[model samples]
Target: RKQLVYSSCRAESAGKALADVMPDETVHNILLTASLCMGFSAFSYEFMPTGDARRFNYIAMAMTGFCTIGYVSMYNGVGVIEVRGHDVFWMRYLDWAVSTETFLLGLAMLSGADRWDTIFILAMDAIGVLCALVGALIPAVVAPAYLLGAVVFAAYNYRLFGTMQVSADRMGAAVSAKYKRLTTQSMAAWCVYPVVYLFCEMTRALDETTEVALYACCDVIAKCVCCFLLLSQP
Candidate 1:
């Protein structure tokens, strides 16, 4: 009876936590489910940071940090309530490592190590964790599509980085133009991904019945835009 009661209480608490974060009662399920999907989508790209040019490198790092923090907060509050003592220690370490890695990656970039560094690995790990949590929580409705996008995005970043690295050898205005275009396009491309994420959350909060559809549409649109932005550079 005591165990049953404890489980019931935990369930109640979890529901409350979910309610608190959700923007509206009507679309609570959608928001919760969407966040879970997004989280899982994010986890898959956590480890492909290799070969990113400076701009892409920085964006990858930022994405990882955002996804990690978002997942930790969402998971701890809404998904896992009865975490065991041993797991608690690991969770603490996970949190610390993610936070520390994010911080270090930022500091390294700002201090000018963006060209080459191992911070990429740390950022990727954080992203992986975020994706895993999403996989664990969200309904698998649109997960496969999201995962495809992530894989494509990672590959795009890799190829872009390779092109930039080779372009460094060019002389005169070509070099400058390549760098300028890359910087501008990458900045523009990355900004859209986060905006799409925020839009999905906001749409859920607004209690829209089309929240999932809208998010999927927006995500596809955003990916297209990012691709265009990247292409515009070369």
Candidate 2:
């Protein structure tokens, strides 16, 4: 009887924790609004001409589509999971895993990077994102996982600045200029993600609502605004 009562109490405590951490109605409304914008962005790509640029348009569409789905899931309380008394939005990581790859694909395509270089960059990106997800889910290994993610991100930057830049430069001054601008914008947006994760997940410096809002801003810039910039280039 004592053991049963203890288990029941723990379960109740967990239930309460989940309830407390879940985004309030305001946050849900924000997510819904973001989802609608992303959905519209994804739909707009359908009219893009089918030619050499079609792949880029499709990649942009996929990135926004994934984000739309992720935001909708979060709004519905579908992908929020409790981890060590905190709520982890696993769908955000899922969104990053696929959407960020599409983002990188656009970069690689724009830079005219060789097959091997493209593969290397994409693989490193995946590793970094996976490390971040693992760190968010498991409290004990948070530091090590974050460090690993950072290291992989550094390798990704090396390729972006060195190999990919070289490829873009060979294309011409115009392409190189465009690639540099877009890459700079992408790096600026991406650098915030780990910092936000560290504060919101590791140190608990920011509350859940702030974390979600910050991430939403980053997502809009990285996926939607960046895609529009890329597609606008001649």
lDDT of 1 by residue, 1-234 (tens): 999999999999989876654333433454355445444444543443434444544444444445345444534443222221101112322543454354334333422333444345345535543543343234352255346435544643453345443444344474545554544454344445434433343122322345434533443333323323332343
TM-score of 2: 0.88
* The 10-residue segment with the lowest total lDDT in model 1: 81-90
The reply for model 2, stretches above 4 Å from the true place, is 1-22, 48-51
Best by lDDT: 2
- Candidate 2: tens digits of C-alpha lDDT, residues 34-139: 8988999899877766466688888889999999999998887878988876779998999999999988988999899999999998999999989988888988
Tell me the number of clashing residue pairs for each predicted model: 3, 0
Q: Where does candidate 2 clash, by residue pair?
A: none
Candidate 1 residue spans exceeding 4 A from truth: 25-175, 185-227
The TM-scores of all predictions, comma-separated, are 0.29, 0.88
After TM-score superposition, what is the CA distance of residue 206 in candidate 1 from its true location, in Å?
Answer: 15
Best by TM-score: 2
Mind sharing the TM-score for model 1?
0.29
40 in model 2: Cα distance from truth in Å? 1.5
